[model samples]
Target chain A: MKPVFTRPRSLADVSTHYCPGCTHGIVHRLIAEAIDELDIAERTIGVAPVGCAVLAYNYFNVDFQEAAHGRAPAVATGIKRALPDRVVFTYQGDGDLASIGTAEIVHAANRGEAITVIYVNNAIYGMTGGQMAPTTLAGQKTTTSPFGRDVEVCGYPIRMAELLATLVAPRYIARVAVNSPAHIQQAKRAIKRAFEVQVNDHGFALVEVLSTCPTNWGLPPKKALAWLEENMIPYYPLGEFKVPKEAE
Target chain B: MAKGKVVINEDRCKGCELCTTVCPHKILALDPKKINKLGYHPVTLTDPEECIGCALCARMCPDCVIEVYRE
Candidate 1:
C-alpha cells in the first residue's frame, strides 16, 4: 500500500487551535506543504500575527516571530531585510491584515519586500467573538452586526487582493478558497507560487485564502463551506489578480 | 476499485467532525464507544474496505490525524 496524503514535514506534530471546519488548518497544511516541497523549511522564517491563527508559530517547524496585530508585514519586512538569504513569510487573518494591518501590508508591498504573506480571510473576526470585519459581507450577520452588515453605514467589504494588486511592487497576488477539493488544489498551487515568488526574489507576494468559520457563522462545517461558496464567493471572486512576469 | 484504509492519530484528533463531512463514501464517523485522552470522540473508519482513498477527509482534518493509504 502507498500513502498519498501524509503530514508535511514543515508542519509540526501537534494539534491546532482553530475551530472545527474553520479552514485555517487546511490553509496551514497548504503552506506547510509548499515549504516542504520547496525544500526550504529550515531556512524559512514565519511571522505570526494576532488573530485566531496567532499561535501559528507553534505549528510550523521553522523560526517564528510574533507580530503585533496587523503588523506582520512590518515584522516580516525587518526579518527579510536582516537576513536576505532566508525565506520569510507571514500568516495573518482578515482582522489582522485587511483591517488593522492594512497600512503595514500596503507599505510592504509598495516597497516590494522580499517576503510572502498567507492571508486567511474568514470575513468575520473569529477571535474577538465574531465582530464585523473589513472583509465581512455586506449583509452578513455578526456579533457587532446582529442586524447584518449595513453597507450604507459600513461600506462594501474591502477586497484586499484587488487592492494590493493595484500596487506595482507586488510580484504575485491571488485569492483562492478551500471549500471543495478542486478549489483546495488550486489554492495550494497559488500558495506555492506565492512562496516561489519570494524564493526567486522576484518581489513581495500574497495569497488571500477565503476560509470558513463554522462556529462564528453559526453553521455546521459542511454548511459553512456551502454558505461561503454561495454568499462569500460572489463578493470575493477567486483568481490571481497579479502575477510575476517570470512566473508567466 | 482501489483498496484503501485510514490511520487516525487519536490524541491529535479534536473530534471536530470536519473530516467526516468530506468523505464521499461516508466511511468515517466519530467513535461513540471510545474517547481519546483529550476526552473527544476521535474519527474512525466504519468500513475500512469502503474507502476509495479520496484523501478529502485528510484535507479537511484540522488535527492532521487521518492518514490515507491505498493499494
Candidate 2:
C-alpha cells in the first residue's frame, strides 16, 4: 500500500502540548507541510511567539528563534536581514500580533521585509486562560470581558489581513480558515504562496489564519469549528485580500 | 470503491474526536474501553472495511494522529 497521507517531514515525531481539539496543531501541520513542499526546511528559520505556541520550535525540525511577547516580527526582521539567504518566518497568535506586538507587525509589513508571517487569530487569548484579545469579536464573552465585548468601549475586532492589505509595501495578504477540510486545503495554498512571495523577493507577506480556541471558547472541538464558521467568518471574511500585481 | 486503510498513533491522539465528524464512511470512533497515557479515549477505526481512504479524518485531525494509505 502507498502511504497517501502522513505526517509532514518538517514536523517533529512527538505529540504536541496543545489541548484536545486545539487547532494550533492543524496550523502547525499546515506550516510544516508548506515547508516540506517548498523543500526549504534546511534554510528555514522560524520565530516563535509568546502565546500558546511559544514552544513552537520544538514541533518543527527547522531552526527556530524565540521572540519576546509580540516581538516576533521584529526578531524575524533582524534574522532575515542578517542572513539574506535564509527563508525567515514568524508564527504568532492574536494576542502577540494584534495586541502587544501591533507596532512590530505593522512596521514589519510597512517596511516591506522579505519574510513570511503565519498569524493565527483565534480571537481570545488562548495561552493566558482565555482573556479578551484585540481580535475578540464584539459581544464575545471572555475572562476579561465577562459581559461580552462591547464594541463601543473595546472597538471592533481588528481584521489583521485587511489592515495589512491596505499597506502598499505588502506583496501578498490573505485570510483563511481551518474549520473544515476544504478551508484547510485553501489555507495550505495560502501559506505556501506567502513563502513563495518571500522566495521571489517580492516583499512582505502574511497569512492570517482564522483558527479555533475550543477550550477558550468553552466549546468542544467539533462545535468550535462550526462556531467559527458561523460567527468568525462573517466578520472576517475569508479570501486573499491582496496579491502581487503580476499574479492578479 | 477505492480500498483504503488508516493507522492511528494511539498515544499521540488527544482524543479530540474531531476526525470522527469528518469521516465520509464514518469508520472512526473513540474507543471507550481503552485509554492512552494521556488519560483520554483514543480514536479507533470502528470498521476498516467501510473506510474508503478519503483521508478526511487525517486532514481534520488537529494532532496529526491519523495516517491514511491506499491499496
Candidate 3:
C-alpha cells in the first residue's frame, strides 16, 4: 500500500520537550525531511542552542552538539572546520540567535563559513517563560514587557535575516513560515534549498523560520497560527533575502 | 457520490503516525507491512472509501505528505 504519513528517519524517536501546540516540532520534522531527501543525514552535524530548542540534540538522530546561549554559529564553525566534508548546521531560536548570539552569527556569515543555520523566530523567548526577545515586535506584550514592548525604551525588533543579508559572505539567506499547510510546504522547499546550498559548499546559508510558541503566547494552537500569519508574517515577509545567482 | 483522491508524496513521508493517531473517523492506518524509501512503515488510508475528506490526516502529517481533495 502507498504510505501517506510516517516519521522521518532524520529525527529520533525521543519525545520533544516543546510545549504542546508549539510549531517547533513541525519545523524540526521539516528539517529532518530535508536532510533525508538530500541524503545528507549521515554527513550532517547539528548544533543545538540554549532556547526552547535547547534539547533539540536529543530529538534529531544525527550527531548533535550542544552550544551555549547564542553561540551555535561559533560551535558550528568549529565543527565544520574539523569536519569540512560533513554537513554542519545549527538550530537556534530568536533569543539565542537574534540577541546574544548575534555577534557569532554575523561574524560567521561575514567569514563565509560553509554551514547552515535554521533560525526559529517565535517572537518571545519560550524556554525562559515568554520574556521579550530582540525579535519581539513593538507594542507586543511579553512577560517582561507586560504593557507591550515600548519602542521608546525597549526599541524595535531586529530582522536577523535582513541584517545577515547586508554581509557579503553569505551565499543564500531566506525567511520562511510554517503557519499553514501551503506555507509549510513552501517552507520545506526553502529549508531543503538551504541544505542544498550547504551541501554544495556555497558559503553561509541561513533559513529563518517564523514559527509559533502557543504556550508562551498564551493562545490556543489554532489561534497562535493565525496570530503568526496576521502579525509576524507582515513584519517579516517571506522571501529570498540574499541568494547568489550561481548558487541558485 | 464519490470523494476526491488522497495523494501522498513518498519522499515527504516521515512515518510519524500522527495522522493515523489523530484520525477521529479511523480511515487512516499504518500498513505495518510496507517500507518506504526512508525504510520506515508509513501510514495508509485503511478504508479510502470511508474517508470523509476531513483533512485531519493532512493536518497531522508533520512531513506534509497527505493531500486531500473534496469532490
Candidate 4:
C-alpha cells in the first residue's frame, strides 16, 4: 500500500512546541506544504514572531530570521529589500500582529511591501496564558478580562481582514478558519494564493487564519474547535477580502 | 468497500483528540492503557479494517503523527 498522507518535506522532522489542540501546527503544515509545492523552500525566508509560534524557525526547513515582538513586517521589509529574489514571509499571532505590531503591519501593507504574512488569530493570547488580545471578542472571557470583555471600555474586536483590505497596495488579503476538514482545505488554498501573489511580484499579501487555542480557551482539543466554529466564525467572517483583479 | 490503515508516531503524539473528533468512522481512540514518550495517550485505530484512509485525521493532527495508507 502507498502512503496517502505524510509530513511535507518543507517541515522539519521534529516535534513542535505548540500546545495540544493548537491549530498552529496545522497552519505550519499548510505553509510548509505550500512552500514545498511551489518549490520555493530553498529561497524562502521566514521571519519568526515572539508569540506562541515564536520557535517556528525550528519547524520549517528554510532560512529564518527572528524579529522582535510586533516587528516582523519591518524585519521582512528589510529582508525583501536586501534580497529581492528571495521569498519572504512572516508568521505572527494576534497578540504580536494586532496589538503591539499594529502600526508596523498597517504601514507595511500601505507601503506595499512584497511579502506574505501568515496571520494566526486565536482570539486570546495563548503564549501568555489567556490574556485578552486585540482580536479577542467583545464578550469573551480571558484571564485579564475574567468578567468578559466589555466593549464600552475595551472597544470592539478589530476585524483585521476587512481593515487591511481597504488599502489599495495589498495584492491579496483573506481570512479562513481550520476547525473542520472543509475549512482546512479552504485555508490551504488561501495560503497558496497568498504565496502566489508574492511569486507574481505583486504587492503585500496576508492570510488571516482563525485558529483554535484549546489550552488557553479552557476547552478540550475537540470542544475548542467547535467553539471556534460556532462563536468565532460568525464575528470574523471568512473570505478573500481583497484580490487582484486579474487573479480574481 | 475500501481498506485502509492509520500509522501513528506514538512518541510524537501530544494526546490531542482533534483527529478523533473528525473521524467520521469513529474508529480512532486514544489508547487508555498505553502511554507514549510524551506521557499522553497516543491515538490509535480501534479496528484497522474500519479505516477508509480519508486522511482527515492526518489533516487535523497538530503533531503530524497520523499517516494514512490505502490499497
Candidate 5:
C-alpha cells in the first residue's frame, strides 16, 4: 500500500490553534501544499497577519515576518523588494485586509508588487469575539451588529477580490471557496497559480479564499459550510477575476 | 472496491465531524468512548473494509488529521 494523501512538507507537524472546523486550517493546508508542489518552501517567506492566523508562522516551516494589523501587504512588499529571489506571500484575514489594512493592500496591488496574497474572508471578525467586519454580509448578525448588518447604515460588504481585480497592475486576482472537497481542490489550484504568477515574475497576484468561521458564526461545523455556500457565494461569486493575458 | 485505508491522528482531531460528512462509505464517526488531549472526541473508522481510499475525508479534514493509503 502507498499513501495517497498526507500532510504536505511545508506544513509543520504540530497542530494548529484554529477552532473546530474553521476553514483557516484548510486554507493553510492549501497554501502549504502549493509551496510544496512548487518546490519553493526553502525560499518562501510568509507575512503573517494580526488576526486569528497571527500564529501562522508557527504552522508553516518557512521564513516568516509578523506584520502589524492590516500591514501584511506593506511588509510583504518590503520583503519581496529586498529579497527579489525569495518567494513572498501574505496570509491575511478579511478584517486585516479589508478593514484596517485596506490602504496597504490597495496600494500594494496598485504598485504591482511581485508577491502572492492568500486572503481569507470569513465575513465576521473571528479573533476579536465575532465583531462585524467590512466584508460581513448584509443582515448578518454579529456581536457588534446584533440586529444584523443593515446595508442602509452599515453598507454592503466589500468584495476584495473584485476591488483588487479592478487594479490594472495585478497579474492575477481570483476568489475561491473551501466549503467542499471540490471547492477545496479548486482553491488549491488557484493558490498554486497565484504563486506561479510571482515565480514567473508576473507582477502581483492575490487569491481571496472564502473561508468558514464556525466559532464566530454561531453554527455547527457542517452548517457553517452550507451557510457560506448559500450566502457568501451568491454575493462574492467564485472565479478568477483577472489573469495576465499570456497566462490566460 | 478499491482497497484502501485511513489512519487518523487522534490527537490532532478536534471532533469537527467534517470527515464523517464527506465520507462516501459513511465509515467515519467520532469515537464517543475516547477523548483526545484537546477534550474533543476523536474520529475513528467504523468499518475499515468499506474505505475506498478516495481521500475525500482526508481532503475535507481541516487539521490534516487523516492520512489515506491505497493498495
Candidate 6:
C-alpha cells in the first residue's frame, strides 16, 4: 500500500517539543522535504539558532551546528566557506533574526554569502514567553506589552524580508505563511527555490515564513492561523519580496 | 456513500480568526470560549451544514485548517 504522506527521512523520529499549533513543525518538514527532494541530505549542513528552534539540531538528520542567539548566519557563513560544495542553511526565528542577530544577517546578505536562510517570523518572541519582538506589530499585545504594543515607545514592527531585499547581496527573498494548506504549498515552493539558488551557487537566499506562535499569542492553534490572516498578512503582505532574474 | 469530513487538527490552529472573517456564509465563528493550552480562543463552525464548500475559509486560514468535502 502506498502512503499519502510519511515523515521525511531528514527529520528525526523524535516527537517535537514545540507547543500545540506552533508552525515550527511545518517549517521543519518543508526544509526536510526540500533537502530530500534535492538529494542533498547527505551534503547539507544546517545551523540552528537560539529560541524555540534551538533544538533543531536534533530534528534534522543532517549535520547541524548550534549557534548562540542570532549567530546562525555567521556560523553558516563559516561552514559554507569551508565547504563551498555543500549546501548550508540557517533556520532562525524573529527574536533571533530581526532582533539580536540583525547585524549578522545584514552583513551576511550584504556579502552575498552562498547560503540559505529560513527565517521564521511569528511577531512575538516565542521561546522566551511572548515578549514583544522587533517584528511584533503595533497594537499587538505581548508579554512585554500586556496592554498593547505602543508604537510611540516600541516603534513599529520591522519587515525583515523587505529590509533584506534592499541589500544587493541576496539573490532570493520571499515571505510566505503556513497558516493554510495552500499557503504551505506556496511556502514549500519558495523554500525549494531558495535551496535551488544555493545549490546553483546563486549567492544569498532568504525565505521569511510568517509562522504562528499559538502558545505565546495566547490563542489556540486554529484561531492563531486565522489571526495571521486577519492581522499578520496585511502588515507583512505575502509574496516574493525579491528574486534574481536568473533564478526566476 | 460519503466523502471524508474535513479534518481540522485543532491542535495546530493559531487562533488568528481569519477563517471566520473569510467564511462567506458566516458558518464559522471565533466563539468567546476560554483559551486553549496556547492561550487563545479557537474558532468553531456553528453550522457545518451551511458550509458552501467555497474553501475561502481554508484558503484564508494561515494555520492550515478547514478541510472541505462532499457528504
Chain A TM-scores, candidates in order:
0.98, 0.99, 0.98, 0.99, 0.99, 0.98
TM-score of chain B of 2: 0.93
**Model 3 DockQ class:** incorrect
Rank list by DockQ: 5, 2, 4, 1, 6, 3
Q: What TM-score would you report for chain A in candidate 6?
A: 0.98
Please estimate how well model 4 matches the true structure, expressed as its whole-model Cα lDDT.
Answer: 0.93
Candidate 2: Cα lDDT at B64? 95
Give the distance in Å from residue A180's predicted Cα in candidate 6 to where it truly belongs. 0.3
**Model 3 CA deviation exceeding 4 Å by range:** B1-71
lDDT of predicted model 1 = 0.90
lDDT of all predictions: 0.90, 0.94, 0.83, 0.93, 0.95, 0.83
Taking the candidates one at a time, how many backbone clashes does each contain? 0, 0, 7, 0, 0, 26
TM per model? 0.96, 0.99, 0.82, 0.98, 0.99, 0.80
For candidate 2, write residues B1-71 as lDDT tens digits: 54999999998889999998899878788999999999999999988888888899999999999999998
Candidate 5 lDDT score relative to the true structure: 0.95
DockQ of 3: 0.10
lDDT (tens digit, per residue) of candidate 3 on A150-182: 989978999999999999899889999887767
Tell me the tens digit of each residue's lDDT in model 1 across A1-248: 79978999999988787776678998999999999999999899999999899899999999999999999999998998899999999999999999998999999999999999999999999998999999999889999999999999999999999999999889999999988888889999999999999888658999999999999999988799899999989989999999988657
Error of 1 at A42 (Å): 1.1
Clashing pairs in 5: none
In model 4, which regions exceed 4 Å deviation? none
Better of 1 and 5 by TM-score: 5
As a whole number from 0 to 100, the lDDT of residue B70 in candidate 2 is: 92
- Candidate 6 lands at a TM-score of 0.80
Every model: iRMSD? 1.5, 0.7, 7.5, 0.7, 0.5, 7.1
Residue A213's lDDT within candidate 2 is: 97
Docking quality band of candidate 6, CAPRI definitions = incorrect
